[model samples]
Target: MASRLAQLEGPIDTVYADIYNESGLRKETTLSKELGFKGKLIVHPAQIKIVNEVFTPSKSEVEQARKIIDAAHKAEKQGKGVVNLDGKMIDLPVIKQAEAILEYYNRLVINNQ
Candidate 1:
């Protein structure tokens, strides 16, 4: 069900994890993140930390997103519509995704600070 939800291109912001079980919450949150759910519903304050941790982009992900944005900018400057990074083609959709990731990461940083 989570996998199917991930397939939807529309925004997903209402998935809920097990509120009574911490372990179950962790697992469910992690799986939801891996499956591309944007956010999860949490009934308890304790669930906030785990849910945020699962959804937050990692250091490596931020770095990769920066690289993708840089590569895309370079390609744009060169009048090219696509670029290659780490031997993989970086197209518009990939660039957009990377930009979105960075945007979300930046928001997290700002909010946390």
Candidate 2:
């Protein structure tokens, strides 16, 4: 169904429907992230922390993003838009995603402060 909706000429975002069962909710959050869902819906207050932790970028992920951004900047300075980072292609979309992860991390830090 998600693939079908994606085939249409509009945006399609994933929304999780499961709202109960703590273990199940955790599993759903992991699956949702793997499936590229931006966020998930939760019914219980207890689920909030777990869901947030699951969705937020990890320390290693944030570090990797920073590295990718730095490498991309260096590549751009060399008149190249795409960069080779650890055998992976670092392009515009990948850079944008890294920027977004950093932005999200900054937001969380600000909120906590």
User: Which is the leading candidate under TM-score?
Assistant: 1
Give candidate 2 misplaced runs (Cα > 4 Å). Answer: 1-20
Tens-digit lDDT track for model 2 on 20-103?
Answer: 566877787788777766567666677788788987889999999999999998998899989999999999999988998898
Q: How accurate locally, in lDDT, is each candidate? A: 0.82, 0.79
The residue-level lDDT of candidate 2 at 90 comes to 94
User: Candidate 1 — what's its lDDT?
Assistant: 0.82
lDDT (C-alpha) at residue 20 in model 1 = 65
- RMSD of each candidate? 4.0, 4.3
Point out the worst 10-residue segment of candidate 1 by lDDT: 8-17
Candidate 2 lDDT: 0.79
Error of 2 at 13 (Å): 8.4
Backbone clashes, each candidate: 0, 0
Under the 3 Å rule for N, CA and C atoms, how many clashes does model 2 have? 0
